[model samples]
Target: MEKVTISAAAREGIGVKGALSKIRAEKKIPAVIYGGQKEPVSVTVSVKDLDKIVKAGKNTLVEMDLNGAKELALVKEIQYHAVTDNPIHADFQRVSMKDKMDVVVPLKLEGTPADVANYGAIIEHILREIEVRALVSAIPHEIVLDITPMTINKGLVAGDIKLPEGVELITDAEAPVVHLAIPKEEEAPAPAPAADAAAAQPESSSTKGKKDEEGNLTKDAAKK
Candidate 1:
């Protein structure tokens, strides 16, 4: 995992009402750094710097420059504008190199499954991310699982993913992350039954038997 230095400055207040609005107007994101067994500090970071760190992955370790003071932190949460999709606020949780933390790592699938090309089986990616426990500096940004050798109906489970040295898998071992599923044959719907088909059609007009002042079969059995 690569660590990035994030420049930050101390804020004036604990972000009371209207304080964040002012910070956002200046194109700055209001953030708070808490934990690491220290007093929480109100801070602000530029939106550009924040996006770069976030794009790298939240699991990325941040070297904070709090108006010149230093601290190591983890991005805990970020609130975004629903309409504009811009960062509104963020929270950074301080962490130490010695502390083991559990964090979610995005799952990346590598190589196409053999069944997909050979048998036209579909690959169902179930779990896109998983949790792992490791030291602050040891956390990985993503987990890559290879499916090149997978066959039809075969899958890679959570345990199949190999973690970096000194990292521990916190996700369940039996949970399936990705799998190959056989495609269902598109069978034409069954033909309608014969009797039902007949009922569906119009009935033929009834024949009027020949009659001499009477409706009855006559004259050589209706000329059989």
Candidate 2:
């Protein structure tokens, strides 16, 4: 895990309706740092810096320099603008190196399963992220899984994942992670216009000369 240092300044007028808007207009994001048994502190950080932290992936360890009072923290949560999809607010949780914390990390699959080419198999990635408990220094940025050995009708469960030393899996071990399935064969189309045309036709020349038992001229004969 890479530790990144970011600069932040104290924020005032938190409850003021437009205080956050004004901070955003200046290319700064409002944030709060809480937990680790200390009072939460409201602060503002550069939008550019916050974006870097986000791009680093979930549970990124960051050294927050709040006016020279350094604190080890993790990027806990972020709120984004619905319209622009830009981050508007962020939450940082204070942490200690000795404490074990549970955090969700992304899963990355590597290599193509051989069944995909051999039998036109489809790979389904059921779980994209997994929760783990570990010290801040032991947590990984992402978990990489090698799927090259998977075969058709085969699947991998959460227990199959390999965790780093000191990291404990918090997600259910029985949860499915990925599966390889064979593609279903498409059914042939039914023969169109299935009704028999001969049976559906009205009486034709074959029946024109025939008369009924009543001895009255048949409708076709009368027309003739």
Candidate 3:
């Protein structure tokens, strides 16, 4: 498991709101450390440093140096500015190295399924991450599943995934994460009706069989 090192100072003389705004102006993130039977502490960290940890895309282990007191923690939640997409605040859960904690980890799919390659089936990913419980140090960065032998109608559910030693899945075992199936194509629309059919055809017999008074009819009169 990779750990992120963050430097924080024990905040003083300011409320959370005031500190948070100041942190944001400095391009830092305001965070709170709670849990494990200690008084919650408010702190601030550089946005650049926090971004590196968040890019891992999961609840990651954090090594925080708070006013020279080091602690192990996990990122519990993050708040972002609705308009600017900047980090507004974050929460960290203090943890003991010996205790187990529930965390969500990313899922990585390996190898193209046989069905997708040989049978022209489509591979669908239903879930890209899952929750699990494990000791703080034993947490895995990602859970990888190989789909090399998968064929049409074959799938891997949460239960089918293999875990590293000491890690246990917390998600429903029957929940499907990946599957192979035939692709569905959209059907083309029917052709439109012709303009004649839509507007009604002209009356067909209106001029037929008319005659002139020469009595050979107009046809013989015109021959003269």
Candidate 4:
């Protein structure tokens, strides 16, 4: 994958309480670059630039220009504000072009499966991404799979994907990536049982006592 170049400035006072907030107020977010057998460096990058990379993909290979020095890295994690949802901080893992690393690449389906139209089968994308081991330069931004020929009940597993040369799948081979499923018919809810009006009604207090043929309450109960 081609690397995207982004500019960053070295930052300090990471332990200071308001230091991070001060960076954000200036339209930048705090970030750190670590790994690759080097000491971690604290830095800050423009919020706009970081957001663009995030929107493209987290696995996007980046070339961080820290002042005059250049470093290759991958966006590992991003912390967001709880209420505003804005990015608060980011972690970038330093990478080497010569070393093989495992990274997740997004999966994209190219076409509708045959069964979708012929049998009304629904296409289920079981795996949205897959982990693969490859050199930084060989890592793919996304993997596209063609599903046009698939039929109902048919599926494509991770092993079925055609990886680019030098890229090896790290995910399980048997793990499902896409499947054409039969749509389930929604059963009509059972009709509620008819209510028995007489059984449901409570006996009125006025009619609680037995009456004689003359329609007068029994004398024995009336006395009570």
Candidate 5:
């Protein structure tokens, strides 16, 4: 598990439209922290700073410093602007050190399958992520699928991967992660049209202006 630290400020007058608008204009995002058996708190954090943390993935663990009071949380949700696609609001769920939680971990394919290029094959990723339960400290940064030993027409499923100790798979073992593909054989070219006797005549550049010993064109040359 990767732990991170971010700072935030307890927001004042957040419910007011005027105050929320001002925060967005300043490039800050309004967020709420709930759970951990405490009343939800409204806070504001830098849009630029929090954006970096979320890019690490939703399962990332964060320790927020809200004006000296610390809280452990998972970024539960992020609302993005429909047009600009920028982060507008965020929701955090407070968690405890002892909690065994389910989080979605990203799946990464690690190697090239054997004979992929020679066979004109492709690797199609089916399940790009999986949910797992573990203590906050036991979550893996990613789920890795090693395909070096996989050959064309082969596949891997959730059962194929061995995870870090203390992590339990919540996804189905039979669910496929990736599979190698072989492209279909192309249809044979239509038999070339039967040769056209006239069209197959010798190239003109090679036979142009030929004449006989009498200085008269030969019968084949005269036909040009």
Candidate 6:
């Protein structure tokens, strides 16, 4: 697997919120390392360093250098500030190169399905990513599937996927990843005819009866 080198430093006495704010202000991102037998370590890294590493995708194997001490880790989770849209925090799980780990890999569609071009069928991607189990060093960044033969009502399922050696799919084999279907056109209901509208109107006799009841109530109230 391709590796990205990211530099980080052990945080000092500052609290997590304060340290995270300071890190963001310096154009750096705050992160934590967990998993294995060790306590989680809070660290900070450069934002530019992360942008380059994140391009390798979420399941990528990352080599983290913490003040010169190196370790192999994988991106587990990332937290982003809702308003600022900045990466506020992240989690990295340490792993051994020889051990198999479960991770989600992005799905890449290759080749235009024939139905989409020749039969006016719309192509829909039901799954954007899939989980797989593989060695940390053998984990793939993305899985590519061909859809050239797909036509209307046809689909490609997880079982049809061909993965690289040593990479086993953790997602359901029968789950559909992509589907081709004809576009649905909605038709508006027809307007009611004028005769039907006239026939449905409330009877004038009922209105007159209602008015008579009101008049009787007013007379009774006046007598009281």
The top-ranked prediction according to lDDT is 2
lDDT by residue (tens digit), candidate 2, 102-181: 98989999999988998889999999999999988999999999999998767999999998899999999999999998
The model with the greater TM-score, 1 or 6, is 1
Model 2 residue 15 CA deviation (Å) reads 2.4
CA deviation > 4 Å runs, candidate 1: 13-17, 193-224
Candidate 4, residues 1-224, lDDT tens digits: the string is 76678999999887899987789999999999999999999999999889778777657888989999999999999999999999999999999889999999899999987678888888889999999999888988899898898877568999999999999999999999999888899999999999986468754676564667775668765765
Tens digits of per-residue lDDT for model 3, 41-62:
9888888878988986476788
**Per-model TM-score on C-alpha atoms:** 0.85, 0.88, 0.78, 0.81, 0.79, 0.81
Better of 2 and 5 by lDDT: 2
In model 6, the worst 10-residue window by lDDT is 206-215
TM-score of 3: 0.78
What's the alpha carbon RMSD for model 5? 7.4
Model 2, residue 51: C-alpha shift (Å): 1.4
Candidates' lDDT values, in order? Answer: 0.85, 0.90, 0.82, 0.88, 0.85, 0.82
What's the residue-level lDDT of 166 in candidate 5?
A: 96
Best by TM-score: 2
Tens-digit lDDT track for model 6 on 16-43?
4576567778998778888877888988
- The deviation in Å at residue 35 for candidate 6 is 1.7
Which candidate would rank higher by TM-score, 3 or 6?
Answer: 6
Cα-lDDT of candidate 3: 0.82
Clash totals for all candidate models = 0, 0, 0, 0, 0, 0
Return the lDDT, model 4, position 115. Answer: 76
List ranges where model 6 is wrong by over 4 Å: 194-224
- Name the candidate, 2 or 3, with the larger TM-score value: 2
